[model samples]
Target: MSEITPADFALFLLASGDMQPRKRARDQQADLAGLELKRHVLDLIVSYAPPADALEATLMQIAQEIGPPYGPTRALCASIRDEFADAASTPGFMEWLIEEAVRENAGQKEKRRGKTFNQ
Candidate 1:
């Protein structure tokens, strides 16, 4: 393989978030089943977040890797969600809005690409 630049590494870290570290810290004991579940959860979220909801995809992936309900990343996501919820009167409905936005954008992108799904 070719040498990876710091810029490339930074982008990968930004994209992968906690997954790299967690996978590396316990390669032998890492929960493969849990990770599989996490990926399923992420894909589910992505299915919901069509186009502009790319941010939500990033959120779900990062949250899952940050490790379940007790990890710092999970807590951070919760806090962010709580704050976002407080911004509205109907409580934490940001997820739904995100999904709708995703669907709308995804529809547009699909039409442009002349294909369905993550082209």
Candidate 2:
């Protein structure tokens, strides 16, 4: 948990698409429970510096534009609430976030495509 940073959280949010700006917050306000762990994890990532890549920028923008303004964790909670409102809880959600961090740090994921020039 201590090892997790804000940038990592943003990356997780971005990759998971849990904080998309297009989503409506009112839709999820009803089931805003069981977000304590996510809130804790989100707090850790506040001071983290995201990578200087397109994905990071995109995530930052989404967070900034959301209703809470740079509150990716809030957006994430809302999303989870909307998607899993009926279910009490789901195990391994945090574990999946950890796996994303490991994969990111190890560069195990595929590389992003860049602009190409004709030879």
Candidate 3:
């Protein structure tokens, strides 16, 4: 199984609202169990109601720890941090996130296929 990274966690958070249904969808199937564990950890932090800056710091720390291929870049982490709250409160934000994740995943899969074929 592929290791989940901070980017995956952030994507999970952004799409969490529809996770259950997405998990059941064939094309959307992913390591939901692993993502759930990450979600639980995030929930623990959120329960403390950390200030925005602190929350962003914590997220950046996670990204650094998970650095590289799957890990998000500092810019991506900042974007995710800035958008996290709106993802929960803004209508349709979750849908947009899910769609973006799917699109990105599809593109990555295609790249992998190309690499394999070329090799």
TM-score of each: 0.25, 0.27, 0.39
User: Against the hidden true structure, what lDDT does model 2 obtain?
Assistant: 0.44
Best by TM-score: 3
Per-residue lDDT tens digits for candidate 2, residues 10-103, read: 4465455342234565765434432433444444344445432333444444455443534554566455333332221346555676576566
lDDT tens digits, residue span 57-111, model 3: 7766655655664333455456556566665467776666667667767776898
Ranking by lDDT: 3, 2, 1
lDDT of 1 by residue, 35-95 (tens): 4544444444344443332444455566766565646455444443343334344443434
lDDT by candidate, in order shown: 0.44, 0.44, 0.55
Candidate 2 clashing pairs?
5-45, 6-45
User: In lDDT terms, how accurate is model 1?
Assistant: 0.44
Alpha-carbon shift of residue 85 in model 1 (angstroms):
7.5
Which residue ranges in model 3 land beyond 4 Å of their true spot?
1-9, 13-81
List runs of model 1 lying over 4 Å from the truth: 1-14, 21-30, 50-119
What is the total number of backbone clashes in candidate 3?
0
Query: lDDT of model 2 at residue 27?
Result: 63
